[model samples]
Target: MWTNIQAKRPVWLAGAAIALAALAAYHNSFGGPFLFDDEQSILHNPSIRSFSTALTPPGGFGFTVSGRPLLNLSLALNYAVSGTEVWSYHALNLLIHVLAGLTLFGLVRRTLALPVLAGRFAGQELPAAFVIALLWTLHPLQTESVTYLIQRAESLMGLFYLLTLYGFVRAATAASARGWQVATVAACALGMACKEVMVTAPVVAVLYDRTFLAGSFRAAWERRRGLHAGLFATWLPLAWLVATAGGDRGGTFVLTPEAFAGYWLTQFEAVARYLQLALWPSPLVFEYGVTPVTAWTQVLPYAVPVVAAAGATLWALRFRPVAGFLGAAFFLILAPTSLLPGITQTIVEHRMYLPLAAVIALVAGAVMAALGRRVWPVLLVLALVAGGLTARRNADYQDEFRLWQDTVTKRPTSAKAQNNLGRVHFLRGELPEARQRYELAVSLDPGSAQTRYNLGLVLDATGQPEAAIAQYAEAVRILPYFAQARLRTASALLRLGRPAEAVAPAVEATRLLVEPAEAYFTLGQAQAMLGRPAEAAESYRAAVKHDPAQAEARLNLGIMLAQAGELAGAREQLGEAARLRPQLPEAHANLGIVLAESGRLPEAVASFQRALELRPDYAAAHYNLGNTLLRLGRVEEARGHFTAAVKAAPDFEAAREMLERLR
Candidate 1:
């Protein structure tokens, strides 16, 4: 019994080492701020605010959680534990990545221990699988999926993908395969809900069975037809998700034939780059923005090598099935993203989250074959190198400024990187530097509506209203549905005091904005400035309806109602406005005016005093307090307030007249 337990020690030790390596490599990443798409997927995602909403996910496409309900639900769970502290989100992401690494270790060890391959890997299975799993887990290329919080979608899907295959392997050797088969199908379905990439797992599972267990496709299918059927049925939910998403995968995919051709051409270069990074793992980029390879000349050089590899993979499928499986897995896992035309990013490193395992396994297998049992030193060096590089990569994510700066330094031409760096600068209140970066971003990608809008915001904040309006107008021209740009354009026009010119963009903004309370409020201000009282009141009411806590909107609506002789309505709006914004002198002053008009003299005096406390020099508050006091027959107090109001505002004719009458 002691000997038997001792025999299992190495396997248990290898699993613990892989988990420890994952935790050590990502130790610094817990403090990494939410970057880029994390803003929409985890930080501001209303769907993840509750379990029910998260299970439904959001309707929009560009967000990470758009149609990925399982991914959203995971985020919701993290939120329940730690809201937006960010550490909890990073912890969950690292946990998912570590789980995937252990699953890969199990799958590789089990596959190598099978009868077909066991002869070559008999005593080396544990060591070889440990090296592959450790290197893959600590790979610098994985930092994007592990450190960048929103890409939890990638790592989480990868976990389920690995589990599906690992479950199948367990089922092949188990006496009762029913439970393992069900678990495999369940994992596949959950993976589909995490990301669209899991669509290839079923095919990969059948290929694994043919290569390692059954020795032929016919036998594999005959033996496990029910299991394969269950696996394929998992695709049904993915099909429904893609169908409901309009097959575009949330604006990331483009289906035009021309787009498909261009994207396919670009993949040759992208695949070649991924292979290079797999070996060297240096200069791992965070964002490789869309660079369409329309001309064949740009793709031909990379295409030659990639095409040769594909031909080699096809050749190996007929002769050397193990090599073929590894090659096929790499290509198959990436085929969905490579074939699909994703407009957001043409080449991203995170797509290698699972494919890296295939690459590492293939390379490690080659080393073990060449060196036999002497491959230990080489594997150890590789593991140490990969772990050190991953730790260094995680250091870049510690500061948002540093992360985007690193991307900008590496990919100077990536306009999206430049725009993000500018956003970090903007958030830090470094206006001049932010403006400079945004201008460079706009110059790099003039057609980018987001970059144009960002530049307009910098210009608007710097008091260049006309220039800001021009940028906003250009953004709207590029993307007509950009409500923020339209709203900014109207805001710039309002700043320039061209209320008539602001009206058009403000109206368009109200139509296009999702939460249009701000747009409605902007339109109300424009209408009021244009002397359209009824239109202004309608716009203010709409703003209040969309966002009941909009104190400024309620205050404006109250003033409008009081002017139109609707005292009761004015009193309600003004009271709520004051309650919502206790420090706003305007809200309390307006409420006091309506109270006096409604014959609430004592309440009116108290409101006026509170407004004066917030703003001692508020001429209007002093004047109103004086009027309310005079109505209460407190003539001495009324005289003192009138005198103070006249002193505060020399142009206050009404206060001066009241003071003279009291004297």
Candidate 2:
């Protein structure tokens, strides 16, 4: 018993070390702000803002499919605990990554300790597995998936993916494997909910059984036919998810021959690039610019090396089945994204979150096999270097400015990166820098409607309305469905006093489902400018109805209603606006005017006084208060207010007339 306890010490110590190292490497990333997709998928995604909504299928929160319900649910859980604080989300992502790493350690150790590989691994299984897990955990290539908040979709799925495999391995070797088998199936199902990549988990499980447990596919199938069936059946949910989800699958089976060849060639290059990054792990970028191969000549250079690598992997399957398993698992996990035709992105580093496990495992196995029992020091050095690189990479994600700057530096032609970096500068009010980045982005990707729209925004802000209108029109021409661009175009046209021209785009803007409130508000502005009061009033009403928290919309709607002689409706809206934004003197003054119109003298006086208190120099509030007081028969008070109004606004003709009438 004493010897057995002593023998287990190194494993426990190594496990603890891996956890600590992972934490230390990612410590700077705990406060990193959300970047890129995080805005749409986590922050602005209302479905994940509440537990009930998150658990239910996304109704209209812009999440087209409820397929990633589990990922959404985890984000909701994080929100509940942190309420939009960046720290908690990053903490959860790190925790998931650590757990996945620990699971990888267990799975590798168990696989190497099996009877078939046991003699070969001898006493090195524990340390070998520890090194693989530690190195993989600290690998800089993993920072994108782990430190980037939205990519929890990848890391969380990876955790469950590894858990399913680890549980299956334990079950295959355990005295009673039934419970473990059930847990494995459950884990696979959970992984499916996290991401579609998990569809490969069952197939990998089958391969693992063949390589380590049963020694042959036929014997494994015979022994665990029911288990195999159950594992395969887990794909049913994933299939249903893909079928029901709104995803970009257009490039799959329908790609034209030219397009297919182009995409296929691009994928080979992408895979080669991924492997290079995995080995070196320097200058990891958030986005890469991939140009499709339009001609055979464009693909030939990449094709030879890619084919040779694939051939080597296949040869390993015939001669060295274990290495073959790792190679096959790597390809299988990547096949969905790489071989699949429709994905817009040619390569994404986070896609390697699971595939990297196989790479690290194979490398560690090779090192251990060559060095025998003397690989510890070399492994330690690799871990320290990887950990240092990971920590530095994590530092890049500490802020959007750093992250996007790094992306632009690494992939200068990535138009999206340039556009996003421009947005960061725009948010910080660095207009010239923002303009420079936006211009660069547009030049790099002339057809990108988003970059055009962003450029239009900066141009409009700098008072170049004509130039801004031109950019906006180009954006609308490039993507007719871009409702925001249409609205911006209308706004710029209105600024240029072209209300009639603005009307068409403003009306078109109202047809979109996204940000209907803003669309309606823009439509109302255009209609009002066209001197169509009734239509303007209706559009303003629609704007307020869609987004009641829109104080400006409510104020505008109330004023329009008052002009349309709907004084009672105007008072209600104006009062709500005042309540929503008490700091706005305009809200209080407008509410007062509506109250006085409806014959509520006391409420009108109080509203005007509140407006004046917020802004003592408010000439309109003072003039309105005087009229309300005179109507209430408070002659002395009315006279005093009228005099003050006239004094405050010496050029106020309306106040002068009211004061003379009072005297």
What pairs collide in candidate 2? none
After superposition, which runs of candidate 2 have C-alpha atoms over 4 Å from their true positions?
1-12, 55-66, 249-256, 294-302, 342-344, 494-511, 527-546, 560-569, 598-600, 613-617, 632-653
For every model shown, what is its TM-score relative to the native structure? 0.93, 0.91
Cα RMSD to the true fold for all candidates: 2.7, 3.2
TM-score of 1: 0.93
Given candidate 2, what's the lDDT at residue 376?
77
Per-residue lDDT over 585-624 for candidate 1, one digit per residue giving the tens place of the 0 to 100 score? 9999988999998999999999999999999988999999
lDDT top scorer: 1
Model 1: ten consecutive residues of lowest lDDT:
58-67
Report the lDDT of model 1 for residue 333: 98
